[model samples]
Target: MKKIAITIIKFIGFFLGWAILSSILPLSSSENQAIWRLWAEIMPLLAIIAFTFIFWLIEKKNIKLHLFDNPVKGIALGAITGIVWLAFPVLIMYIAKIIDFDGTNSIDLFPVWVLAAFLNVIMQELLVRGYLYQMLKQKHNIVVAAAVTTALFTALHGGAFEAGVIPVLNVLTMSLLMTVVLEYSGSIIAPVIMHFLWNGIGALVLDGVSLADDYPNMLIATFTGNEILSGGICKMEGSMIVLFINVILTALFMFLKNKQGTK
Candidate 1:
């Protein structure tokens, strides 16, 4: 009973600590949109990182260590998986006339935004997949750990409970794919790159990806078909096609993990 309570407190405490840090971070009043935007982008990431490393320090784990068994291969595989899987559904959306390319828009702080995005990716990977995952797995099995962390992840991204069913499922399954990458590669490196690539490429290629509105995109696109096909107000994220792709990819990774004789 004590063990379970401690595990639960740590998980909940992580989020609370992050929120407290984020709330207290000082802000300089600036008329510059880019400066303000960049500050907003970096603050939560900074909070997450700051709070997370405290846990790492407490656990006596070095933050410099990369989690992948083979860093080089993990990088390569992560890139491929992120690019290919993302492109697949997009191709289908284009061919099926669910989306159409229009033009492009530029943002004042794109380069900095990209760096922030990378940091955001790395921070999330560490926060969820790092010690939190291992701590849970110590008390339970891998699937339980994965499921719990994935739930927290989805909630953070505004996809769980409050969102519609499809968006919730989209975030849930997408998170599972990342969790699978962590498990299969035996490191968070693969999932980190994979998440960043998906966000980076999608933000560049499509209108409603991670960096939309406040960020620049190479192509301005519009959705025309049914809401489910086009992802409606949620864009490609809520699309049925994306959900199907996620399901397929999740199954594939699970199969691979099983074949590798990894428990």
Candidate 2:
């Protein structure tokens, strides 16, 4: 109970620190378009740096920001997992006649977006899986720790609730999968790779399709406006098929990892 309380307090404090820094940081400039764009790409990284320091101050021993046991293997597995998850729904939508490919063009902002996604994955994995999970697992069982961490992870995406319940539920499910990956691999690298791939693909494909009017140099695919089957604002990740795939894949990963461990 005491450990859990301390973990919660530190978690709240870390976010509070992030909020304060976000408000006070001079990274953004209203008068300078270039500076604002740069800040937009790097804001998540900066926030993670601040949050890490705050967490270190609160819980010095539990923070494990190391990448993983076998980074190469982790990255490879993560990439495969990410590709499977991402491609499955896109293929389904395409085959259902719900997606119409409209051709491709280069996004000038693609490089910066990639960097941002990489940093965002690093930041999230370190915070949620690295720090929070470690803190909880110190006293609670893995199941309890994973549950608490996943709950917090899902809560962090509360803003996406506007997209609908399906999207929010999907986020929760993904969080749980990420936690499992981190646990089995004994590192954040796998989950980070998986996360970046998932988001990167979505930003490239889903956002490209959805925001074609807003972004000219995008590989657009017009999809049917069905939030249930085709997914609305959240795209493929929000689809029922994607959710089912996620559940099955997560269970499979856990089972395989457990079997490997017993050997």
Candidate 3:
């Protein structure tokens, strides 16, 4: 009972900390990129970094985020993994004639968006897989940690359910995929790069990654087919095909972890 109580308390408390810190910078949805950055990317990331320091400085818990472990190798692995993550289903959909490139809407501020996206990914990985996960693992176990983080991750993206079950399932499976990838690589860097690539490239080249906001997509992709293939208004990440790919990757990584005797 006490264990369960502690788990719940810490879980809720950690999220509350994030929420409080994140709101330190007032949220905004401005036409200006600088103002948007304060809301879209910077605040959340600052919250995560601040939370990490709180653990280290005050709580004295040095979370093993596996960041900067092997810079070149991590990025290399991440690039390959990220490419594969987007390529498999995207290629299939394109080959199926559901997706076609039209043109580009180049934006001068594109680099800013990339920075925002990268920082957003970094903050999310750190918040879910960094401190909270390590805390749970130390106090409980890996399964517990994974479960809590996965649920938190899904909840954070609750907008997926607005699209329907497939998107929701995709988010769920994606959470699982990141969890497994973290175990396999023994580094958060792997999933971070993979996630950024999945979103960044998708936003740039494809229709986008089921994101709520619209940006200057480099390629004007036209999709015509069943929602199962093209993902309809939800874009590629919401595709049934993407959900399937995520499931397969999740299982494959699980197998890899088990084969290597990782818990």
Q: Please tell me which predicted candidate would have the highest lDDT against the true structure.
A: 3
Model 2, span 68-133: residue lDDT tens = 578887888788888887777777778887667777766666665566556666767766787567
The TM-scores, one per candidate, come to 0.89, 0.85, 0.91
Q: What is the C-alpha local distance difference test score of each model?
A: 0.78, 0.70, 0.80
Q: Which TM-score value belongs to model 3?
A: 0.91
User: 1-263, model 1: which lDDT tens digit per residue?
Assistant: 99878878887787788878878887648777556656776787788777777877865773333464788868887998988778888999999988898877766666766775676677778778876787777656787888899988887787434547887888889999998987788778889988988777787547656543565676788888788788887777878898999999889988998999855
TM-score of 2: 0.85
Better of 1 and 2 by lDDT: 1
Supply candidate 1's per-residue lDDT for 51: 73
lDDT (10s digit) by residue, model 3, range 80-133: 988998999889988999888877776667777777778888988998888788
Which runs in model 2 stand beyond 4 Å of their true positions?
Answer: 30-38, 57-66, 206-217
Best by TM-score: 3
RMSD for each model, in Å, please?
Answer: 2.6, 3.2, 2.3
What's the alpha carbon RMSD for model 3?
2.3
**Which candidate, 1 or 3, has the higher TM-score?**
3
Better of 1 and 3 by lDDT: 3
